[model samples]
Target: MNFFQFFVWGSWLISLGGYMGNQLGFSGLQIGSVYSTMGIASVFMPGLLGIVADRWVNAERVFALAHFIAAGALIAAAGMTDFASFYTYMLVHSLFYMPTLALSNSVCYNVLTRRNFDVVKTFPPIRVWGTVGFIVAMWAVDLLGWTKSANQLYLAAGAGLFLGCYAFTVPPSPPYLDETRKKSLMSSLGLDAFVLFRKKNIALFFVFSLLLGAALQITNAFGGPFLDDFKTKYPDSFGVKHPNLLLSISQISETLFILLIPFFLTRFGIRNVILFSIVAWVLRFALFGLGNPDDRLYLLILSMIIYGMAFDFFNISGSLYVEKMAEPTIRSSAQGLFMIMTNGFGAIIGSYGSGWVVDHFTDSGGVRDWPNIWFTFAGYALALAVLFLLVFRDRRIEDIKR
Candidate 1:
């Protein structure tokens, strides 16, 4: 279930930018606008549908239905030639697809708990397969020469269809009809979690989450196309020839770094964990600015490797911090708020903002200044880190009043 769940996303997530820009000649803003669909959908879909799964429908069934709809949307998107049509189809797909990520977890947890497995211990091993699936999909697409073609979408659609059918066979997970708590669209939007803003530390943490979230999208939106550009300069280079495979290293690094998060959080405290993550972000972009497909390829590799630290530290650590700080009654809502700040608002900022940055650096002849663009991103991250260091204060969770 986990494997095919991510298999659907891995088939297209990293390579779509390359396809849109290289094959369809989309401008950076247009491409970014399209990628932002995930963010736009993410803002409301997951929470809204989660309410349905919790109160009205079986989660597995909802999960299955979402995948089936997303599959059709992917098929529609694959046939689109213009940005408007492609964006519309992809937006429809994102609306149904983004929520399934949470639904899959819900289903897994429900089944695992019913079978008497220790969720904390058993779920990680099972979940790691999702990353493995993602890496495998990246390699598959790269090797099949589908990176710049619409075929990746077709592949994803096939996977989505299969997963949708398979979801029904999972353990029966009925809605919790006894859940008496009122769940509304506004609460689902994380507006209830806005009360956390009264606390200075939590407020500051979320503000930085928004900023760093912006940094996360810069690489994802452009990294593949950046490597693809190298074909003009070093057609025979491995990075140029297999950008997806090279990019897969970041996912591989993610799996490794997630294992190390426990030690890092215990040793350094959450503040320093976040600091390390911000510093790593600075390197992630700077290394990209300095590296290439040839002599400086090592820099690119190093960047990919550090991505594990840059991404996992803040995201996992931030979630853990939120869990520790929020009262038990509001814990789930707190997590939802964290996702909203990062993936929702932050994604919108990152997608549109990075697209503008990319266009600003590109010449009228349509040649992008890749290094300068990366350097500019690095500078943005650096500023965030500096401001964060000055404004945020760390307090022990035990010391804070609930």
Candidate 2:
């Protein structure tokens, strides 16, 4: 289930920029606008759906229905020639698909707790397979020469359709509502999870989540186009020809780093683990600024390797942190809030902001000042890391366990 869930995303998430720019001739701003659909949907859909799962419907059914609809949206998106039409389909797709992210985690947590499995210990290994699935989908697209074609959307659609069907086979996760009890509107809508913000530590953590989330989309939005630009500059380069395969190294590293989450969280606690991620983002962007495919290929590979830590340390561990801290009744809502902060508000900022930066550095001839653009991004990460270190307070894992 985790496998196909991410497989659908991997098919196009990284490579979509190159496809839109190279084939469809989308401007940088237009592409960013399209990607921001994920953010717009994420801001409300996850929380709203979390409420539905918590009070009204089964989570697995919601997951299945969302994917089934998303499959049709992807197929329709593939046939779109105009940006307006494509954006509309993708917007529809994002509305249904973004909610499923929180829903899937909710379903998994429900089943695991029911089976008496420790989530911190067991979920990472299972979730590692999602990265494996992402890698496989990336390789399939690369090997099949679909990176800059609409066929990638077809691949995603097929996977979505399959997962939609498979979702019904998962363990049942019924609503947690009590019929005898009368609930306030906020509680009924799952907005009660917002109360966590009243706590200083939780509030600070979410603020940093928003900051770090900005870094997440920068790479996903531009990495492929960055590598593919080499084809125009140095047509003989391996990086230019195999950009998808090259980018797959990040997913490969993600799989390894995911397995280390249990140890990192237990030993270093949430504060240090997240700090490591912030530091990694600093290196991730700086390396991109300094390296290229020819003589500096090693730096690029190292950058990709560090992506595992940059991504998994914060996102996966943060999800586990939410699972540990929130009450059982509101667990789904808390996870949705996490998604709202990271993928919702943060993604919107990153998408539009990065597009403006790229456009600013672009010349009249359409050549982008890639190194300077990357350096600007690196500076943003470095400043955020410093701010996080100073502002966020640490709480020990022992305290969390108690």
lDDT (tens digit, per residue) of candidate 2 on 1-402: 999999999999999988988889998888888888898888999988887787778989989999999999999999998999999999999999988888889999999999999888989998888898899999999999999999999999999999999999999998876653236766854576898888777888889988888888888988988988777667877778888898899999998999998888888888999999999999999999988887888999999999999999999988888878777777788889999999999999988888899899989988888899899999999999899888886766763453
Candidate closest to the true structure, highest TM-score: 2
Weakest lDDT window of 10 consecutive positions for candidate 2: 180-189
Which regions in candidate 1 have their CA more than 4 angstroms from the true location?
A: 109-123, 172-201, 319-335, 395-402
Q: Could you tell me which residue pairs clash in candidate 1? A: none
lDDT of 1 by residue, 1-402 (tens): 989998898899899999999899999999899888888877777766766676567888989999999999999999999989999999999999988876776677678767987544455557767878888898999999999989999999999999999998999877654333355554444354567888888888988988888877777789988998888899999998999999999989988877776666666667777889999999999999999989999999999999989987887667657655664334334555676678767888999999999999999998889999999989988998888788776745332222
Candidate 1 has its poorest 10 consecutive residues by lDDT at: 393-402
For all candidates in order, the CA lDDT equals: 0.82, 0.88
State the number of backbone clashes in model 1. Answer: 0
